[model samples]
Target: MSSSNKQAGSLNEKAGISSPEITNASAISQIKNKRRQQPSAEELISGIISGNRTTLSRAITLIESTNQDHTEKANQVIKGCLSEANKSIRIGITGVPGVGKSTFIEAFGKHLTSLGKKVAVLAVDPSSSLSHGSILGDKTRMEELVKDENAFIRPSASGETLGGVARKTRESIILCEAAGFDVIIIETVGVGQSETAVHSMVDFFLLLKISGAGDELQGIKRGIMEMADAIVINKADGDNIKKANLAKIEFNRALHLFPSKKSTWQPKVTTCSAITKDGISDIWETISQYFELTHETGYFDEKRKEQNQFWMIETINEHLKSDFFNNPKILSQLDETKKAVQNNEISPFAAAQILLDKYKKI
Candidate 1:
């Protein structure tokens, strides 16, 4: 057979055309080395202070880690960044599903960046009960803002743990502030206990709503209404403008029914279209007014001090719960105890006592 025929017959023969490598071997090796080499706590702190987004994200990952070994290092980094933290305005935004929370955040975030503000968005995506994984698609949703040089968006998974995302979010805010982000926006999962958790951590909590969702007055029944620093009616454009205006009026009326807030600043109701960017600046103005009033009244600092105390207590409670569940003896007997309780062989309280006693013995 001819050489050409032999080449055609050989299925394993190399291609006739030699393809050039698309990637650099040396660069790939350097990236691998960088990934393998973990920066020390001090280095992470320094990087965060110097506004390195990569280091800030790495440090936040350490905080979110469930590995016991990472806890100490995470704490050290947080401690070093403490002073740099708390300088930024922490804003928490939440809403019901389909309320365009991501779109509104993108618009709001872009508006902030336009004013030369360094913005960091911590978006918490709900984790699946079965898979225990988060889609974490906030970056995809906020396409324009994600590309903005002055904006940083980090999406985190809201784990099964009660305080999982909340605790990590609080810590991540500190890192973002240390990274020189003047504005920090925390977008909650919009349901469950997430709103309350986020409310406790933020200086300003804005609830995003849409027109014609339901009876406008119905929202007043929710505890979230009480916690809101402002309620924004999103997607108010084209034909929806009139409905949005009506919703705003209804919400404003509803706001007046609630007793005066401790901060003495009434929660404002406004409308905006994330697509058109209409009324977006007005929302910022409202927030600025809130900060101005709160600062003058000393509520800004006072609320922060109180939140710090609350977190300290929450931390102790969380550690206690973790230690109790993670106890080896309890883990060994947990299934049996749970089975006994489920079968009515033992009372829940008594079974809990048994676990407590076992933990105590250890």
Candidate 2:
């Protein structure tokens, strides 16, 4: 081979085209800025009150965190925002697993935004029992509402909370209200004890249902029926329309059997289709009528006051339980204590007492 040809084919020879820079200093600087320390309570409060969604999300994340420092900071932010909070209506919606909660919420939330209302949805996604993780896929399900500038959709893991809700959901609502959202919607894991927890936090409790093959009133829980401010039969379109109307009548008749509510507002049964968007506006109108009546009768403010008091006691109980379980001595003995009870070496009550005594001493 010619010497020139050998030189051209050399493996170590520099390429005719040069490669671009591997790192961009400007990009690194931007990333560093993004990774800056958490904001102060005052800064978060200011941003939230000014209607910044990013700041509001960060504040909610802090509230959800279990770290000691984060909890303290979250408390400060909540206190600062408390005055601006409680200015919005909180609505709790729940139903059976296949009751189209995500669909109904999207339709309802979009309707609310169209009427010049800022809506925030706190959806509690069920967590995996084995993995203790959640998909948090509500944002994916509500495609349109999520993209709407005026609508905020936040999905949190149920995380061992009895009511299929995040423990910090109440605090998140306060932040959302302070951020100037006119409407706050809480979607629970399903219809169970979670409904009662959600019911206490919300101004109105809505039970979503769909027509089934069996009797409409058969599987309904009496406590849940009594707690409902409104029973909405969703998916009232196509061939299901007639069945939905029949279910509505059955629910209405059942509701009338309950004692009169303190608010003096009769719980109404209505039907709607989330997919076709039919009867969606009417549902809102019914909700509006509820607000008008409750506000005029002073039941709205009174209910909130009662809820606040109830939550105070609940907060104490939660902290006490957390402290009991988290104590160093209790943590060391809990598993062994459980095993002892399981093996019949000790009564469950006795085992629990032993742990409680140890906790008290600690």
Q: Alpha-carbon error at 158 in model 1, in Å?
A: 0.2
Cα lDDT for residue 297, candidate 1 = 95
Task: Name every residue pair that clashes in candidate 1.
Answer: none
Q: List ranges where model 2 is wrong by over 4 Å.
A: 1-22
Candidate 1 C-alpha error for residue 267, in Å: 1.2
Off by over 4 Å in 1: 1-33, 163-166
Q: How well is each residue in 133-200 modelled by candidate 1, as lDDT tens digits?
A: 88999999999999999999999998885533545888999899989999999998887578888988
Please report the TM-score between candidate 2 and the true structure.
0.92
TM-score of structure candidate 1: 0.91
TM-score of each: 0.91, 0.92
Q: Where does the lowest 10-residue lDDT sum fall in candidate 1?
A: 3-12
